[model samples]
Target: MNRSDMNNMAGSPYLLWRVGSLGLLAVVACVLAIRSFSPTARTRQGLMLAWAVAVVAIAASAFVVPEGVSDRALLNRIDPASGVKCATSIFVLSLPIVALLGALMGRAAPTQPRLSALASGIAAGACGAFVFAFCCPFNDPLYVVVWYSVGCAAVAGAARWRLPRRFRL
Candidate 1:
């Protein structure tokens, strides 16, 4: 985005928090997944920790709506079709990252590659949805809950479905 656009967005405290929180979770998830899937092969505990952190972060993001917008405006933003579209696009965009991470985590647990795949998917999905905070102009908390949070989950689900087959070793 342009400098002016960024400045405008930055003016909104809620938007900043929304992006920052999700971004933090995404980074943490990826870090933990990488650690667990590394050559040294950390335990599943790291992956579980990452999943817990991501869940909490997503839950918290539900409250980070843009502060100045009116309730009417917020309500108007609650179109289910648009939310679904937005979420689907986000999930589609994140697939490559999820797949790449899954491949990198190849055979982390020979008997349970699914765990690594799941972690990689969650990381990629969270990061992908976090980017939507920049593009989405709506400051509706409900919007964030439906589109951003659920979108990340959809990405994770999609990744779980696709990654195992693609990354099978």
Candidate 2:
């Protein structure tokens, strides 16, 4: 579609709100995951593994399959053809790297579990934003912040739930 058509597609306020809410959820989930882990070396390792798996899974899903129709409809509000491929690529490349870095940093330092998770989440968000800059160039900033953030959070939450009780916060 033409530029105006693209603009019209992406101008919905509600879509922005939905994406933002999801992003916030992601941040909360990350926090929860970190807190769930025990304050031990093993728990730290577990947390790192959890974040890594979640990031990889979400990023792969973004490309291997179309985002959920509901998600697309929301995204289409910003760009009828959101650059799904680019977004997926960025997510796939950046998330693992960031998670790994966070894991290593956490391992080497005396950071708290919650702090480590939050740090990783922030890194993930930054990577998401970088990916969005190239992929969904026409979409609203809110969409990027929300959907990507939420995706990260979902992974973190799932990891927390799956971990054994001994490792729980």
Candidate 3:
């Protein structure tokens, strides 16, 4: 996008409203999965619920992007490094949450410590991404999926490696 386009959308309430609402929806679902999965129950319901929310979020993103614009075109709006910025932001905020969740899971005695901590880390990453959405100017669908997904995976990987070692079982 050009200067005028950037200026126009920079403070667009519609963009904020859409991203905020849907982003929170995604985060909440992930959190629910984390909450349920951390316990010993290990039911599939919570994970499935989170997956359903993810599907809805992905479908909604098609609408979020401007009609008829290619994914590459969307990056011109501002900050070619927006994906990296967003991803870094995700780590900064989510790491603490992941640690907290991991600590909780350790105390709760999950059936599989590593797996449970990893899942909770993913949810924590989503929570951080949701919080950063307000500050991240880039609203492209590709940017959201690629960088956010990376951030989640990175956190989850770290949690899997770190959290399991803390447990006795």
Candidate 4:
């Protein structure tokens, strides 16, 4: 397919999936940051910082990686279109429920660091899966796992670092 064809393929559904996943990641990261920084005066500020950092990290990674990597013969074995559908479906189905569960559990036990981490991990996994689905036929699964994991970790680390002392449970 030509460049125009590729651009056309990345239309509404793809945009929606990408935007939705990013939004979900932002929400989850914010929640985790808030939980970590509970009782702090700068909780909101910290969350914003975390969000900014996550966006920068994702953007940087995308910019550095060449699109040609996804067009390899082995990578093309998987249907990118179908993969995107699967990933998007998984993300849409999982994020809200996981977010809700995190909120409920967080309210009940605000001091649980492990719980917060688990929530962050779930969000990361969802994002990774979605990215992998869309990037199929053009990238290796291993690359997806590695880069996505790194992206999620960067976000989670930023959230954790910005946590307020009162919320450091």
Which candidate gets the maximum TM-score versus the true structure?
1
- Comparing candidate 1 with candidate 2, which one achieves the higher lDDT? 1
Q: How much lDDT does each candidate structure score?
A: 0.69, 0.44, 0.65, 0.46
Q: Which of the predicted structures, 1 or 2, would earn the higher TM-score when compared with the native? A: 1
Q: Which number leads on lDDT?
A: 1
Look at candidate 1 and tell me the lDDT of residue 8: 67
lDDT of 3 by residue, 1-169 (tens): 1333556776665466445654765576456645654455553555566667666766666666655445345445434476777788888888878877866775675766655766676677777777776666555666676787677668767776888787776
All candidates' TM-scores?
Answer: 0.77, 0.38, 0.74, 0.34
* lDDT (10s digit) by residue, model 1, range 37-57: 655555377667776775676
Model 3 RMSD vs true structure: 4.5
1-169, model 2: which lDDT tens digit per residue?
Answer: 1334435545444334333443443454345444433345344554565456445534433332223433556546444244444445445545663555455444443235444454455445444543343334344443454455554454334322332222224
Backbone clash count for every predicted candidate, in the order shown: 0, 6, 1, 3
* lDDT minimum window of 10 residues, candidate 3: 71-80
Off by over 4 Å in 4: 1-42, 67-80, 83-100, 103-106, 109-169
What is the lDDT ranking, best to worst?
A: 1, 3, 4, 2
Model 2: how far residue 13 lies from native, Å: 18
Residues 69-154, candidate 4: write the lDDT tens digits.
Answer: 55666545344555455445444444544455445545644454543544444454445444444534333333443444444555
Off by over 4 Å in 2: 1-90, 152-169
